[model samples]
Target: MVPSIRFALRGATLLAAVSGMVAATMPASAKAPFRDLNHNGKRDGYENPDLAVDRRLDDLIRRMTLEEKVALMLHGTLQAEGGRGIGAGKAYDKASAQELLSRGVNSFITRLGPDPRTFAQENNAIQKLAEATRLGIPATISTDPRNHFAVTAGASSETGGFSQWPETLGMAAIGDEALVERFGKLVAAEYRAVGIQMALSPQADLFTEPRWPRGVATFGADPATVSRLAGAYVRGFQGSADGLVKSGVATVVKHWVGYGAEPEGFDGHNYYGRIAKLDNESFAQHVAAFDGALAAKSAGVMPTYVIAEGVTIDGKPVPQVGAGFSKPMIEGLLRGTKKFGGIVISDWAITNTCPEQCMAPTAEKPQGYAIAMPWGVEDLAEEDRYAMGANAGIDQFGGVDNPAPLLAAVKAGKVPLARVNEAARRVLRLKFDLGLFDNPYVDEDEAARVVGSAATQAEADTAQRAAQVLLENKDGLVPLSAGKKVWLSGVSADAAKAAGLILVDSPELADVAIVRVATPHEMLHPHHFFGSRQHEGRLDFRAEDEATKAVMAAAAKVPTVVAVDLDRPAVLTLLKDKATALYGLFGASDAVLLDLVTGKAKSQGKLPFELPSSTKAVEEQHPGRPDDSANPLYKRGDGIVLP
Candidate 1:
């Protein structure tokens, strides 16, 4: 058990009625106080574990003032801009973090886990500060997906030394329900070890659109596959196959509905990607992908930023606004039809202003950092945006620290105080249910042993190896002989030596040439900060490209073996004729690849999605259709095996 500074009860006790039950008229000395929440001399009804969760929430929410309630509805980040990256701060920033805690905001989306032990220490300090507040509400630390192999910049951050596994698509490539669930449980153990109680992940978005920048994050284009794996992910993370548990990480299944149907493959983070082209059938399929996650009783659901264009639900035309600002998407669709009773958190920075810097770098703000995504409600004031989102059933606002606008809106009668209370109940219920109110601290020493341990990493390395799809092996050329003369590209010499392979100076001098390459993409929309980093446009490689040129030159002299990381499906027509062998990877280390090559580990994955035949076929296919392109170079589930 974690040791905490317990506050002693004072001289007298005050009998009070809370959650409609009167406390027995007795001395406070009858029982020991539970952390002295509300800093009272006696134990409150909310602090008593004997009471039910709903009743405890009722007692806590009624005690909270309007300011405290508003603060509960607003979630801030460790960073001011609310971006993604690993930050290893040995000490907590009192000026930046304490100010928010003082304002009664205890929840934050933190990206501070550099390692297990250091991350635990940083989180403990923050929780201690929350315990010092008047109500002593424990801090609920949340994070982006950080246990992945190849983390994306804006979508998911680096693994922070956690056990590295293949991307979600790779899990789909392997399609093992048990293995995926094991990965989830392992992730939960590591996260809890580091004092993180909430996970803002398990993105249930489908990879329907071939060119979508964030498609790699999804399981696959198939609704059933995505739904099945996403549910397994939530079940594992939340520690129950049915619902949330006390020792589980509260999982948030996110970007709810149609985030993967971007017409031009742009993300909703920028203005250009705000409109998602969705017909009625396409939207239904998209919604179906989240069935498994919803069925697993996930603790939280985040609305997507994109507006569902050309769509309707139950014969009613959906509102032509971003899902965050639309009542039909939140209150009607998610809560009413789908029956999702979880906390509804809005995506980050939806209410902030999209100034020149947000759109593009201007002369005055050349290094633009602040971001906003008020896609359809740009005309409204900041306070109006807050009221609209709250009324639309947004339980919490992510990325923004201050609750002044919400407080102002409530005072002006724009938003009802009752709505804020409801939001507070939903938010506080999670904390209480997770036993955060009881024990929020973690053991730092335990964290060091659990996170990134060899046992967990061995399981992940197996997944990475099993997820690689062997696309081609001409004349049974795979299972390369270890002693053969080999030339490497994107592979290290140490890894080669470990695999017992002889290395040569050039591809011409070697018996076989092994080259690694990534899927082809164009950097379109360079003006926007997110778009500049996004993988958009063409998926076919040109002859002038360095990797393509090297492949062409090497394959002419030796039996060239190519391994491409399939973040997004690239047209493999260019390499079909030239290469003797092709291996498609979602995420794998040089050693994992070498193990597969030397027959130490057997290749087991099939194509998660089809590889397109040409750039013209990519442009012509519908954004919401799965594997409907003209004559795909490789069909879905296509793979080869060594005899």
Candidate 2:
């Protein structure tokens, strides 16, 4: 006799809760029956009894109708309609949320404010809304990478919550997989405490080029290193348990296929052309990291907006004139070849930018552009976004404004029913695997206690130690005396507002000025392609440069230290000559730097990529080129010792 659906669900929930209790009681080393055993990384295949759960999930999914299934595939973010605010605002209040749910919205992603209590309260409110709905479909709250330092907005801002750790690239420089895993585990614990079930992070993208602003979020350039770190991170964040609890929030390994290989080191910029003779090896290496993630059974994969060569769907290339809707690339490469059975998510607003003709409007038309003057393409329409993304096997739509159109399209028979069911099944399976149905809530009091707790603080401290990469410390130039009346300059330091050597009111102040440079790609107008060697202008020096020079001249009177905050290494010729000492702080926090300078913590990070001396050098050893012999700068792995 077939088991009752409700009975099976109750049993599943009980089993999951019991497993959580067991995990709390058992020692970390003791092997419980529900502990994940495939050891291949992800929770794929029927290796252990957990396979029974998969069958039950399939049974549950099979019972759902086409409309209900389609609803499950739509995941909504709290981003405002005009991109002005986060979370459901006055315009999108609980009533609006209820309306969306009535129209078939299946999932919701909420942000955590800086205050842990506030975050919990907001989450509880959202959860209450979900419970009030007819289907009782649980809301899955996801936050930005909040493990260390708050990235998007300040903690006081509505979008902020959780202590920020060092950037992922900084973590990679430590070269400690164990440390990476620990970071993930701590992040997971915080998420669990807050009732957040999914973390849209551990950006598995490789940092092939230093100039990419987002590179700081990646592990490093090496595929193997990224893969190992990514896998370990998945294991750490997702927990090693089979039943649930003490297990990790589901890990969403992101920027799915190819994203890290943007030309000229900028994200969401020009796609690498087929004829550009780009570094295919570097591009291929990105897949290696995803392979690691897949092996670990990362809960989800996110695709990027960049187009890759020879990657197409239905004979159409991707991210090009008319290719954002490519099917083969999404289904064949990501799901088929990678054997990824998890959900596939598109990057923010990517689907909206689909279709060849869609363009985002701009004020002016630049030279050498193919499209009309000043008009930007809106890649994919909202309706087309759902149809194309779902048909292409995308399990969920992230950051989508109004999912009503998508649902209406499905109801009108515009989208295929089978496609909807397939994507929905994956989403349900993940929720089930996460044990969301059984333990859908988190302890609000416990959340406040656990977030940034002593244990998490310790882990953050460890991450700080691992993330410090000393770019240059010539002849023991570092470890400066704490009490010395040192001159510090730069927007970052000046923002601190301490007394020292002062320069002009601008960034050019100090006994030492730390200048933050723009990413290389941002330096160019949108029209310039990768091969353009035109150095139309010299590097723009900020007031900070003048201040840095003044400080260096005054260095004879008093010692000076120049701190450089960078995503990649760029030559500051002024620093080469004027400063008493220069140090490169690649996205390290103020506290981390303070600890390093004051000897509170040791700087142990190493360079994860090469630092170019000049734009000329960058042009010579262009990222798209096959050879690296032409560049003159610090080779990969070049860094100074702080001790």
Candidate 3:
């Protein structure tokens, strides 16, 4: 049995007593007032709160073994039961946390169990484990957008735990810079409350390709507009121009370079849809958002999963490869030209091998889906892929739990030890800058108090209302009387009545009819539940289609209003002549739409992208260019205002 205290020991004596012993593994003889990391029997410079941030970071890095350094530069999320990415899982438990932390994982993708309280509790538990480790390095938690109502596979979460706001596209439609900033501040507060120090969001991808699956999350197609909104978003998350506040989440602005301009409008899941023929002229518009984000000093940036085909930087041709592995794009452009000092994380699973079916398993490829997006170097070994990305200037690996490959690469001389040290240093610097090392745990009571607050919800409602743009208010048919009889489809009758309109089942018996239609999409991966119907292929809808014809027939009988949820810029030519008024909504509630039409809220939104005049124009337009559709029905920023 060990003595309770070596009270008189100092310096050499202390070192001799604690040799080969880890502070965390020892039994408590006397409870420590403050943690004595490394069994030193006293606080070290790295553990000293008064020490400078860089000094603390250096001390900690110097003490870390190579394995620990590799762990610090790697990240992963808790897998759900049956291999799903979300939902309840044993992965959030202490055992799993210990396994990952013991391997030196200093960061995690957030995996809150159910509610805000649970989220706080689980994160606290994880932080406690980290605190007890030999180095006491706190794990920084990061997450995709969770404060919005839209759900996509592997992108965002369901909005039950936090305040629900308009999607990013909806926020852009409102065009209020101040309001956008407020939304960012609110999201940052909520994230901090739940112990999440990093935000993997504010997608800087331009809305150039209308048929692109992720446009619903972008801030439209125009460079200037998106650039402004992206900058405001970064400010909100990062706090004032000076630096981050305690509540701020270090925003990781994403898909650096051009992810939205996929060839043929397909997503990054396949090789055929990579970014191709990207010249300086077209590339400038795509990088505009990143430039804006960089100006705000975003904490980090994420590369795209698809390869950039034939793209050039500084008049030099870039090899065809994913942004994570491309030296010219990431090193030449983002680092050298833009002079970005922030960490660069590869998109999820970019270093893994592409299984037969990339992405979540679907009925077409039932073998099980996994997006091993080793795009340009599909033939390279997995370890070599990781080494290549790190050597190319990527600082961290996303979606990887094992650090053995990185360790092996260093041992084999594929990646220099100095490079590993540099990568680990960048990641640690972010943690130190965010103040996570000092206090990584959150207050549960505070989390409950601030998350989903009434004021925040009201602001979301206002923003949603503003995002509803009047596209074609022919004959001033809007602001229809509250007492008017209304026939509605895709809207709840109770909600319509609450807006002061009398609900009617038949269009012929009603004074006016309203129908809500979603932009049509072809189903891609049906088996991935939340990720299914990921719209791909054609972007047009015909009037003669069964669903379109039925809605039009009802709309023909009375003065009609149509609202299209423009996830993608849909062909609106068919409904132009038949409807009395047409509106565009990115993502909103039934009551918010009623509020706008009933004059309770004014429409301040403008078109973020063009509405193609016909399906043929959509087919003929270039995927890499924005606002190039021939004879567009409505150009970018076009919004009809009615008295």
Candidate 4:
């Protein structure tokens, strides 16, 4: 680390050099102010694009009031009118423009994505509204992963017109740093084209426990591999291997610490599934997985919703609070140990009210309305939670709109105003660095032209084709001739026909059969919102299961090819033994799979996480460890080329 004095000296020298260049190039009469952000008809330091980020941040924070700072720290959600863009001449909220203009809420996570042009328009409207405020602090709009096939409500979304690539694990399967970087660049471009400035993505959490519902969103089970891929992901999104740049999308590398180590493989999104078992030694490995992302200078980091059950730092038991609220987790670990100086944003709904519906739901009254993820701080008062979190290094609250609790806490000396000012500075610095204040509006035509263009789609198509891992190909069963009669399940008949395979009514009358199956899951808890949608529970295919039955019956009569969507690695023992050919899929489409089957494409990816031999193996393995099962069907890095 550079000494404060030396850093200051360097800054002064750079400023002198830059000022000399400007003076030498421009005449006094020709010079014009960069921006009139406050509409005062004069230039402010924050409004000047040429100023250093720190100088601009200092200027901006100095001008902000306590209420404005509190409101700025709250990362709210925006709703698009008609589910496309904000209503014309109106705030995204139903509130009047005067109400919005009075506050300093300048950052938001948008769920209003219908198309590229509409998304750009909505963001432009928000920026235009911000310009009318006392200080024209442009809003930094963020979104979850959208350039993918997976469309989990809170996790990832489908690309409306953006290039669709594999899930993060699929990128891990390919395991090419360059390829993942390319994919990230495309995602970054698509996001910026639509005026989205920040990306709440590139989850660096290791795929430790296979049954963890969010395993698919992660890079597979090795710290070194996860680190490499995570770094590439950040480099691509931020448009630099070194740090965040003006043209890049700010990447929030997420679920910090031990999120993937779900005890009993239950997700942390629910009350009953908040604990993640990580012994002192194993905890280090989990933290090490984020090294790559951190090294690449990820613009932000979001702490996990789960609590680390058995973690300690420097012989002290780490507080068993959600990472976002734990001083030990954030201030002590992330800041003191990892030295991440970027913005620390809390995961969604950390300060929300966990009503009866959210806490406990039955078959009839499922968890719906009041979604809360306060985890270890469930019983704390709202103001206490905010005070604890803001002091613990959380800069912003996700999924929260009202800033009254935080403001009250700050006013009553529960949370320090200094911490609030620091948080506000970080937020404003990011916006300034992204050049949002200069020009937040994107051309609608440019957005429409750039997003999901044929070139990007072609690139995505190739990635989809390469993400499939070949495991078993018996007796030249794969690369099946296009003229063969084929029976299909979980695969579209139209896709099979397009591959020139003659569709057969049943396996008995076909020369071959193509089947695609999701790694089987049980809806043990139908009450919770995430629990109902999550692919949870046993990773083995039982005989009575419909997908298993379909594969069995089809293989009974003809040579069957099976493709398992390994959202989480499945125990493929039975199918690998019975089917003539088998492949592992991350986010491949039916068309991509069919093309591979007909010799138009080839498998280029390897197994990302280990494929367990049985459900017993999955149960016996440690939640915090990776690829350590006693016996596995195929280990990580295992693959076969279908000839």
Candidate 5:
């Protein structure tokens, strides 16, 4: 027998609710086989799972207070210590989270321990707290990209026993939209297993600036390629054709518009984010990358921490403020023209008044001496900042816990109650569509079963091999014969042997020299470790840097193969002429690299972005444009197919 729960609702009820009230209809006896606690015989509008989502959402919003409505628009990070919530050194127990839920917050971001069981267990605890609330509003848990191999503080979390994959740029190297989509499906299943409903990713920003610190997270520089893959990625996460289903993870296509082009190649933490000379056509191409995603119905968007410079909206220049605070940009461009109605969340802490905490601060350098990133609204009061963002069409503020400021804005007449209700409606509507209220918990054993299964790892392995771009194989030096005596650097002795080659310590004793080197950058400090990941300013190597000198010295000795990890493009002009072979890697382990070199797998990847010949080319290119570097060393899509 087909389940009655699957039965569709029929009536003029939704139309009546749209007119602002749902009149009750009572049957003599209920056959719904569940509680109609309000005892109307027919379920109440809010309680009826059968009602249309719009009617149910209206029922809830009309019942909420100005404070509760405002509370629904704020998201904060919940820190956990030993399975217990911790905030401000208080016992912030589950009871405390339950209390907070009653006051109303439906979204949270958190990092869990590297154990899948612990992640599932802790998530269930939080969900139980939400279930006990007055309205039983299910909390949507969000997380940064956590399935990558590398874990940098504040940016990415380590794969907590989840299926590991290469960096997003590496996937772009493979140049296969279907593979990227498959990866998306695998990531979504793992996320749902652990109760993570939203992914703050597929970073839709173009990697036009090779030196931007966060370039590694992007899907490379070509708008067409990135656009195709971005759409596929969204479809992979949020189920295709039919919107987001239970197995899918809601995608928040991010850094809305453009965030990749930070002026002077600095990270977009402050005024350095002001982009210049951005014309209409260039703006269209940069945004083309997100076109597929927006068309695919991405559930949310996040504005970057930078201000877009010189953009005209409605025949006037856009206000030079952060994207979150600019009404012309958010309301005019994204909301009106782009036609996106999903939740619009500000990048973390955009509303904070204190400079020290607002700027990217490190544990070592706790006092943030760098300029705070309130952008154009630096002079506005905290309540006014919240008011401006809210009125400008931002649906929620990220990384803020308190609801007092927004509530104050409403009371001060700076923001209307209707606007607050509008934001609340969007947030609650998404929760209902995700079906979070029905089943928010996970089965601990099932989570362990699906997270890092062997099948997922095999796909990652195949992707790693597919992602290796063979840029140069001079004199047929690649696919080196298996029995060759090899002098390897940057790879361990056992790893060399695993590739079935004799390991020689000195270049003099070997038939050929194979050296693996990373694209080097000058280190800057006294900031957050995640900030350190950003390769600011010059993307070059001097003749005398110790690491560069050593790698060159290896090339100087014998026939050499240079494997460059293109985390950001390396200035390899000096090494290009000397090496017998060259390769570009996005992100892969030693084994994957060895397999490509030793003919275990064929090279199928290509350059996702241009590799500039000099830092001057990088500096001269327009930050807001795509594929615009001056005289790049290698053009986009450059790769050698093996004969």
Candidate 6:
């Protein structure tokens, strides 16, 4: 047994030894304090003498006051803004962090950046802040899906220290649970090395619709598939061999119940068709994945900005109130029905709904005074966030600028003091479970050794290899002869930068630039998920595509090979009709692509989703429905014949 487990066992044995005589004389039906021992504040284990740690937790909870319980729920991320980046900018610093912790802030979320050494440094800085605090509340460094390609700005930099894998969709295409688990384990190790105690990732939201810009972040459409993969991911991330980081870094299974069925694939912008409205059966199907995640002991749950229609709060419908601040869903559904004992985190900047945009600065509205807005109107004030979110049982506030409002609310009797204590206690318990109190500092040298280590790079390579889907390979279009003057066509295909397959430090060394074809990120216009949809957001194909086709038509004069970066595979059908020889590539690194074409590596990937022949085919399918066989241009699981 691991030392931690053994230590726990010994501690339990000693306690039992002290109570043995009293226990033997007790009646059979009488309950013993041994039933609850660890005092971790969570009901984790059963009534067994062998399981003393469980008892200790029960004992701890029993001793905790209602105020302390409230403290356990008040988790706060140190950063103020919500974007795809690491570290809070000028808004928050070490001094502010110290001040917050001293004022009773229990949880702190930090970003994991591209560089491992930077992460260690940032963590060390936070450690000092924790040490300076009166409560000695250890901060939990939280990352936003850093395992894959770092999407956020500051997160992409090496200063935060994280390993980069393929996008989540790439992992889903691999369909290898064990590999996914391995990825999670590596990420956990990197996190542990950097003083990080929580991983708010393994985004389990199923990508029911492709139109959703964030769809690439999801595992895919199937709940069973997501469940198995997400469970493995959680197990790998939380479970540890030494029990040091075991319960590995606490996993936060996110966006809670239903975020996959969003209308028009918008992130949280549209709520019309987003919820899982089916009866208990359908709800079960969607929630089954979360069951697997919870079974893995996910330490946190984040509710989205969008609300379920039928779900209500104080006799009011959910959409009327921001879902993040809703009481019924968080308290009733998540905590009450699901029995989730972990922290409840609100989405970034979800507390500041008054100003329309999250990051925008605005004036506070009067109490109980509703205002008109494009999304909706409500008596929603910054102070209202605390009352509604806390009363609703939210334990943490993420991506917020000022927690002073929440603290002020507590002082003003807007929020119950008991609730604050509950939130804090829960945060403290998680820190204790993570062993952060014992050793909060991260070793920069050790971080360098582990973050982006050779093993992690190998995992990335493996993931990249598995994510490469061959959409179409017509008449031996691939496996080109090494000496042939292969003419690459299309803007994205021509420029290594646009291809996104190559991890280039410099763009000049690129092999060639065909004409331009828009990448999926460019084609779909990511901002549309926020509500804006204009042709400008569409692919700059008029100029770029025409140039690409002209070059490809010219390249057809020679023994040329045309490869298109298949972000949205539909582009390939257009390219296929024009090129003499064509091959579809999905997010492969340039090196990987070169190897495949040069016959150095074998292409093993199959399509995870169907490539429609046209946009019309896509429009015909139900927005969030997965079964699209009725009008699928090309069936899913289709792969090209490679020579």
Tens-digit lDDT track for model 2 on 188-211? 887877777887766787765445
Backbone clashes in each candidate structure, one number apiece?
0, 30, 4, 0, 1, 55
Question: On residues 337-407, what C-alpha lDDT tens digit does candidate 5 reach at each position?
Answer: 89988889888777877464445465655434333457778789989999999999889898777787788
Measured against the true structure, the TM-scores of the candidates, in listed sequence, are 0.93, 0.76, 0.92, 0.92, 0.89, 0.73
- lDDT (10s digit) by residue, model 4, range 359-404: 8898778886568989888889999999989998999998776778
lDDT of each: 0.83, 0.56, 0.77, 0.83, 0.75, 0.55
Candidate 1: tens digits of C-alpha lDDT, residues 1-643: 1012122222213212321132244445654445566655466778888889888888887787778888899888765223333233344564466667777788888766467788888888788777767787898989888877655555776677799999899999999988888999999999999898999988899787788888888898888999999999999999998888999999999888799888868888988788888788888888999999999999999999999888987789888878888998999999999999989999988988777677666555642456789889888999999989999989999888788888889899999877988889889999998999888999999999999999999999999999998998888777887698999987888998899989998998999998999888887777676777778887887898888988998898999889998889888898888989999998899999989888898789989899999988988888876777899999989887565
Kindly report which residue stretches of model 6 are placed more than 4 angstroms away from their true locations once superposed: 1-92, 112-114, 153-161, 240-247, 269-285, 309-320, 356-378, 407-418, 489-555, 558-572, 579-586, 627-630, 640-643
Q: Is candidate 4 or candidate 6 better by TM-score?
A: 4
Measured on C-alpha atoms, candidate 1 has an lDDT of 0.83
**What TM-score quantifies how close candidate 2 is to the native fold?**
0.76
Estimate the lDDT of model 6.
Answer: 0.55
Q: Which candidate is the best by TM-score?
A: 1
RMSD of 5: 7.4
Rate residue 454 of model 6 by lDDT.
Answer: 88
Instruction: List residue ranges in candidate 5 displaced over 4 A.
Output: 1-44, 82-102, 270-277, 354-372, 528-530
Point out where model 1 deviates above 4 Å: 1-33, 80-91, 360-367
How would you encode candidate 3's per-residue C-alpha lDDT over 316-415 as one tens digit per residue? 7777888899888788888898888888988887888875555346576652445567888888998999899998988999988788887788889999
Candidate 4 residue runs with Cα over 4 Å from true position: 1-34, 82-102
